[model samples]
Target: MKIKNIILLLCFITGFNTAFANEGWINILNEGGNNKGILCTPAIQKAIEKASKNGGGTIFFPAGNYLTGPITLKSNITIYLDAGSVLKFSENFDDYLPYVEMRYEGIMMKTFSPLLYAKDAENISIKGRGVIDGQGKAWWNEVYRIESAKGPIPETKYQKMWTEQNKGIVYSPYYQRTIDKKFFRPAFFQAQNCKNILIEGVTFQNSPFWTINPVFCENINITGITIFNPHSPNTDGINPSSCKNVHISNCHISVGDDCITIKSGRDEDGRKYGIPTENVTITNCTMLSGHGGVVIGSEMSGGIKKITISNCVFDGTDRGIRIKSARGRGGVVEDIRVDNVVMKNIKEEAFMMNLFYDKNTVEEPVSERTPIFRNIHISNVTGTNVNKAGTVLGISEMPVQNISFSNINIQATEGFTLNTTDNVEFHDAKITTTLGSSFKIENSNNLILDNVASMKPIANTALIKLTDVSNMMISNNFPMFATDVFIEANGAKTKGIFLKNNVFNNVKKVINKGAALNAGAVVE
Candidate 1:
């Protein structure tokens, strides 16, 4: 069909965008932007350098408003954004001045340049129904004046004088603030060390930072996207650091932090780039007010394993399926799998696995920097109203191990907390708290609470509360029609607790040995 590709397919059938080259579509108004709302960044970087010099293609941005700046991308590229397009960007932070090799939140620095940047390119894509706006309210007001500045705060004019300047600026892994150019707010679509990747049906908005970041990428596929950065600080919605095969589906995030975060790099350059955000698969997503609706790591030092979160749906989120790490982040989050989720109005911990996220009280000695959470498996979950019905906080030098929770249900206001854990299990779980202990175990050991139940037991606590727990098994039960201590054994190293075949009418005291338990420590 070469008559100059049939007169550019009749100038795209008379709608006029003469850059149609067969197997590799392209328009940018036929490159060398002559119009269409100004700065089209040299006509979309000359149609991605003329389709990477004619070996790769698909660069169309048909319908309207585009004001661009930093856009690199290469190798087998694709950028189709049709339906009324609106690629807006450019709040002009010096148009992302010459800086490349990025990584930001997981260290590996070299600022700016990330309003759709790509590096170490490979097969890439960015399909669309179109609207990508990273206007991020004046770049989050320069991070709120570099976090309400205090002392020594020089360097502005967008830094860069061969940047190497600093006055401070750590900003929470617990403190220090006021430095510029190192970890600058850019990233509204980033890709590094790229591999086969794709982003589909877009709608991304307000960004300036963490709005679809994929560093050290591998085979990845994101689908039916729709992210809206509310409030804006940190604006995270789809972060994949040190990546591996990832497949996120049908998303509809609401961000301003964690509506999909899974990093594998942070401390000691993340164990010196040990590369680990492993095989992930998040499905049918729908999260609303961010800050954990699928979060992993308070920067997991290069180790987050086989992940899979399924049939998701969280609303008014503030934590749901969160796994955080700490203690110098030595890294080793293992086989995780959450399933059929559905949370609502959760304002905090509706399922959490923590490893002491740094208050760093200093009680050293666990080598390699210590940070290890193990074999996680959640199932048919449901949380409602929640304020806490979650927690497996480990760290008495490293404990969070083998965790399990099947057919779970939570309706919280405080309940479900296990500390410094070990092999934990809670099948057919049910927590419907309104106050205290609906399940609380501390300095844990092996435990199994099959058919675990609790409906609103807080009348003088104890629907299961054991401290310094030892190997325990509290079988099938339904407590809380009246339940007033259906098992309460405290400290004294709570020896081998047991209570087989449970169903104490409505339990009024099926075993209570508190006051530093002894007397063979709880068995009935």
Candidate 2:
């Protein structure tokens, strides 16, 4: 105990601020850090292996509590956590030993070793303002009793060699109950095939699962981070699977599932790891009570491109900008861009694109596993107290094409629903609903409603409600005053309904052909 009397006896018992006693800094209390909290993972893995064998620098963790387990970060490392540090992670499920090769929630094998791990490393970093505690409620109650099969299914040979290397390449009965719960937990920081990664200003809390999980990484930067797992079931916050040039900014997430999620793996092992979670950027973030404040894919099979979400803010999030996949997850979510978002209290759908996310109904024939939500663009978005002011579902043999919504505003209680979507375009949109029809088309086709509007029209519906829709164009709108009908043509494969130069204010009727329309379907 002579590293200056163990830093003057743990700095007079844990006030520990010897101002980082300068020396090319590798001080985890001179590689012994035991202010009596005992199990100091070999003095913080020997101060990150003595700063990766004296080539890299700063493995410092100044003020207190470093109860550890698995902390491995090699190449050119930096894991500095100074201000009243608390890197406590050890819920003790065999101290995360003997199962390594990571990638959970999108399936690759061998688990339990990600309490800050790194693989194929390159200039890695995990920066300051310390907290990083994953005392995750007994690993979410033994993975909720092995995913509700009610406990005890552990038959180890490393769960029979990880069920013969992740069985038949993930087809899902929830991936055989996560290999019979033998891979119950792991991930509260994972960096695989890493390169130039940086996680700045940390806080990260109780997460036995996903909280800053990076896989197949490249140039990554997560800034001003603060994640708090609200309930910790799946606890996802910043999950960048199959990463590419990524950047998430000014963060503050409240998680228990999806507060920033994007994937590119799963299904035929993510199309045999074709590698694509492309050039991403999520800017100015703040989302609370997560379940999706920017979620893409229900495991998109190796394809998710050019994503850019801007100026974000969501409160009490349950859904705000979600793009989910299905039909065996054969991915291609093209050039997505959601800008200037502001959502409030949204507990359902404040803009969501669903390719039938689950309940895989037998509809095969459109090859490559058929899941594609095309060239997305949602701009200047705003939602308030939303329950549902958005739902674009496609899957009548792969539809959901070219989605576009510009300067949109929503106040929901149900409105803005499309089905079997196609070239969707709505510029300067406003959906203020109290119930139905503020644009609720079905079996859609090239839908374009420019300068659209609706001001709480839930009277007798019809502010636009077509069915079996076809190439529709409701030109330059924005003339409201309640409504009884402003176009409501139904089924029988509704024809190219056109309403040019619209300005019909106090509407009582403006076309409501319900009897399976024919004669010029709907024209005003």
Candidate 3:
């Protein structure tokens, strides 16, 4: 089908009325207003059923506090909350009874219903200047209590144990077993297998799990949303899993986990489904106090492609632009472009691509489960007060390839580090570090450094260090007033290195080691 026809079909399927013609608007208070602090799930569900039966309309909630349990959304429906209104989820876990199909931490399984959920629907939206409070303190305390009892062995290990325990039940190696329903907290909003969805102008807070999660959906638009989940665990701002054609803009996110995360699936289940999240665009967003401003995967086994993130600001985040996956999760992540990003006070590396996430470092033979990262380009980025400039650590068997950076500036305590990567290039890059070498390359190949330099001179540190690297070209660089030792190469594998048309000043001796001193290897 053509794209326009597909969108029209989605609208028809979801009962979206672009004109908002003579459709009826039903108010829950008029239907049955229970102002006694009682459960309003039944009344709200009735109103929604009525609206859906009447060919879809708006279910309006005026200025009041409505306590409810899980609410399911229908197609062509809009849930509008006026200013000074709040939809507060009940704290009682029993309210969210009956399991629902949902993805938890990249694993798809049956669990408690999300606070607000929709499945197999189209053209649905939730828009308003109101608040949807998860009242997640109780759930957070419950999870913490369980973790305290389980002891500290890293969350992934515990998750793996749970996944193994339920192997017979879920019939998938990657599924997590919820020993008890109360222990598993649901997300605030989850939509699955839907299209033409819109979530705008809403304030979401204190989510039990991820704030806004959409799985296996398409054509989702989220804008002007504010999410604040402070000091909470696993409360990522927005996570779009196995989705396509997604656009997120003008959002302000501050959460305990990653602000915006793109995921496909996890482990065996992910490989089994073989769905990819593609054609995503995120722009003009402000992120604060999250694990990562924009994260690709720790659970991307299904693959991800054609993602663009631009014109974003990240402040006080643990990391910026982090892509992480382990060896066991085999997937391809490619064609990622990020530009015009500004970051300040990053707690860790400004840009990090780590293929070694799990603790197991043992070498294994190449298989279908080997992760691959390639064709990533980042440009026009600036960072200050960063702990580390960047790190690219790829696997030995399938090294990360074709990564490039241009017009980048970083001020940090340490510089860039590359390991087991190939075909990486840096152009017009300036790195200022307080300690350690400005650039460290190990077991990499085909590296091109053009017009790259360190911002200031530092004593007792080499400006660039290469070990076991080959096929490198260092040209047209300004190493003036930098470290005394301009470039140092160690290990016998260092060969095919050519440095030309570079300026060296202030009593610096170049080529400290390995590569033979020749006309082609070094030219002053």
- Models 1 onward score TM values of 0.39, 0.40, 0.90
lDDT of 2: 0.83
Q: Score residue 261 of candidate 3 by CA lDDT.
A: 98
Summarize candidate 3's per-residue lDDT along 1-524 as a digit string, tens digits: 69999999988966756435535788888888453557799998899899999888888888878888999999988988889888889998778766677888777776668999999999888999988899999889878776666544444333454444445433233222334322467999999999999999989999999998999999999999999999999999999999999999999999989999999998887888889999999999999989999999988899999999999999999999999988888889999999999999999999999998875655789887898899999999999999999999998888889999999999999999999999999999998899888799999999999988788857767888888888999988876664588788887777788888777765377778764433344333
Local accuracy of candidate 1 as per-residue lDDT tens digits, 1-524: 58999998887786543333355787787786533667778778878888899898888888888888888888899998888888888887888886665777776666677899888899989998988888889989877876677865776755643255332322334422323333377788888889999999989889987999898899999999899999888899999998999999999999888899999778777778789999999999999998889999878888989999999999988988899888877889999999999999989888888888776646589976788999999999988898997988888878899999998888888888899898999998888888887788888998898887776666767777888889888887766488777777788887888778877888777776768777876676
Identify the superior model by TM-score, candidate 2 or candidate 3.
3
In candidate 2, what are the lDDT values of residues 188-208, reduced to their tens digit?
888898899998998989888
C-alpha lDDT values of all predictions: 0.83, 0.83, 0.86
Model 2, C-alpha of 387: deviation from truth (Å): 15
Best lDDT goes to which candidate? 3
